[model samples]
Target: MSKYESVYIARQDFSTAQVEALNEKLNETLVGLGATVAKTEYWGLRSLTYRVKKNRKGHYTLFQIDADKDAIAEYERQMRFNEDVLRQMTVKVDAFEEEQSAILRNRDERGSRGPRRSGPRQ
Candidate 1:
C-alpha cells in the first residue's frame, strides 16, 4: 500500500446539495476500493490562478488515502470520467508529514492571533 493525496476541483455551477452529494459519492468510492481514507478537506470555492474551462473559480476538495498503485489509478480514471469533477491530481507521499506541517503552521498562527469574534454591521 502507498500513501497518497488527491486534490480535485469541481464545476462552479453545482448547487450546494449537488456538491455535498458529490463528496459523499467520492468517499464511498474510495472506501469501496479498499483504501483507508485518512482525511478529507474542502478548501471551498476559490479563484483559479488561471481560468479553467472558462471558469474563474471552482470548489476544491482534498483527500488523503492509503491504497495500492492500481487503486490509485482506478480512482484517477473514475475522477476523469465524472462530469462533476473539473480536474483532479494524485500524488504519492512517503508518510503523513504534510499533516504535521499543517499542524505546525496552525500553531504558529494561533500564537500570533487571538480568537476571532463575529458581529453584525455597526
Candidate 2:
C-alpha cells in the first residue's frame, strides 16, 4: 500500500450535513477497498480564485489515504461520477503532515491579526 493525499471541493450549494455525508461515503468506500484512511479534514466553504461549474465557493475536504493503486483509482472514479463534487485531485505523498492544511492555518493567522486598519501608510 502507498500513501496518497486527496483534496476535493464539493459544490457550494450543498449544506454542511450533505458535505459531511459525502465525506463519510468516501471513507466507507476506501475502507471497503482494503485501505486505511489516516486522516480527514473539512476545511469548510471558501472562496475560489476562479469560478468552477458556476460556483464561486466550495466546501473543501482532504483525505490522507494508505491504499493500493487500484483502490485509489476506484476512489477517483467515484468522485468523478458524483455530481456534488466540483473538483478533486489526488497526489502520491511520501508522508502525511500532522498539522492542519495551509488554508486552515492561514485562516487562523488572519483571525489572530484582528481587524484590518483603514487608510494605510501610517
Candidate 3:
C-alpha cells in the first residue's frame, strides 16, 4: 500500500457534526475498500482566499491514508460526486507525518499573537 494525504473542504453551511459524519462515512468506505486511515483531522471552518461554489468559508478535513491506487481512486470519485464537498485534493506521499499538519500547528502559533492593530505608523 502507498501513503496519501487527502484533504477536502465541506460546504460552509454544514454543521460541524454533519462534516464529522461525512468523514466517518468516507473512512468506512475506504476501510471497506481495504484502506487504512492513519489520521483524521478536522480543521474547522476557515475562510477561503476566493469564493467556491458561492461559499466564503468551508469546513476543512484531512485524512492520512495507506491504501492502494484503486482505493484512492474510488475515494476521490465518491468525494467528487458528493454535493456537500466543496473541493478535494489527494497527494501521494513518501510517508505519513505523525505530527499535526502545518495548518493546525500554525493556528496554535498564531493564537498567541494579540489582536492586530490597524493604523498608520506614527
Candidate 4:
C-alpha cells in the first residue's frame, strides 16, 4: 500500500448538506477500494485561481489516504464520473511525508495545548 493525498474542489453553489453528502460518498468509495482514510479536512469555499466549469469559486476538501495504486485509480474514476466534483488531484507521498503526517495527526489529536499558543494573549 502507498500513502497518497487527494484534494478536490466542489461547486461553490452547493449547500452544506450537499457538500457533506459528497464528502461521505468519497469516503465510502475509498474504503470500498480497500483504502484507509487517515483524515479529511474541509478548507471551505474559496476563490479559484481560474474558473472551472464556469465557476469562479469552489469548496476545497483534502483527504489523507493509504492504499494501493489500484485504489487510487478507482477513486479517480469515481471522481471523474461525479458531476459535483469540480476538480481533483491525487499525489503520492514519500517517507518524509509519512513522518510529517504522523506528526500532524498527533498534534491534531492532542489539541493546541502545547508550549506555543496562537492569537492574542489576555
Clashes of 3: 0
| TM-score, one value per model | 0.77, 0.91, 0.91, 0.77
Of models 1 and 4, which has the larger lDDT?
4
Tens digit per residue, CA lDDT, model 2, 45-110: 999999999999999999999999999999999999999999999999999899988978998998
Assess each prediction's global lDDT (C-alpha) against the native.
0.83, 0.95, 0.96, 0.85
**Pick by TM-score: 2 or 4, better one:** 2
Candidate 4 lDDT over residue span 1-122, tens digit each? 99898889999899877888888988998999999998887767889999999999998888889999999998999899989899999999863243444535765667766666679999
Judging by TM-score, tell me the better candidate of 1 and 3. Answer: 3
Candidate that scores best on lDDT: 3
- Of 1 and 2, the candidate ahead on lDDT is 2
Off by over 4 Å in 3: 114-122
TM-score of 2: 0.91
- Model 3: how far residue 67 lies from native, Å: 0.2
Clash pairs for candidate 2:
none
Clashes of each: 0, 0, 0, 0
Output the TM-score of candidate 1. Answer: 0.77
lDDT of 1 by residue, 1-122 (tens): 89998889999887667777898898899889988888877766878899888888888878889999988888899998997788899999987655534634675777789767788867
TM-score-sorted candidate list, best first:
3, 2, 1, 4
